[model samples]
Target: MLSQPNYREIKSSYLITKEAIELAKLQDIDTKKYKELLKSALEQVLDALGISFDEIRGIKKMDAFF
Candidate 1:
């Protein structure tokens, strides 16, 4: 398990990547790379938390994060 601070930091990084994806979309730039990165980061975090992707449905902004 990750320490509380480490977990928070990881989650922050994931959110930053999510924001980058949105910004890229707004700029009409291809967001494929950013989306892939966000997905990978999210998968890792979910694994760390022992949570399934399905468990977060409707709780998080799926389009932004996935």
Candidate 2:
């Protein structure tokens, strides 16, 4: 995700959080806490943006404009 120049910091940060989960390399040792932290971070970001995960991905895909 960070490889995309079109992805701003917020989007990159979001992807980083996801990558952590995908790679099982979260800083927190506890799996439950890892999920909680990722969930809380995602929820706070989405709540502030007034959108959800699916919506963001849809927007990104549409942005390809091909």
Q: Residue 59: error of model 1 in Å?
A: 11
lDDT per residue as tens, model 2, 1-66: 376877766633333433345565546468798677877788778988887655655645565577
Extract clashing residue pairs from model 2.
Answer: none
For model 1, how does the per-residue alpha-carbon lDDT over 1-66 read when each residue is reduced to its tens digit?
566754653333333435554355566655898777777779889989987665675565476677
Error in Å for residue 59 of model 2 = 18
Residue 62 of model 1, lDDT score:
73
Which one is best on lDDT? 1
In order, what lDDT does every prediction score?
Answer: 0.67, 0.65
Candidate 2: C-alpha RMSD after superposition: 20.2
Q: How accurate is candidate 2 locally (lDDT)?
A: 0.65
Model 1 C-alpha RMSD vs. true structure (Å) is 17.9
Question: What is the C-alpha local distance difference test score of candidate 1?
Answer: 0.67
> Cα deviation of 9 in candidate 1 (Å)?
41
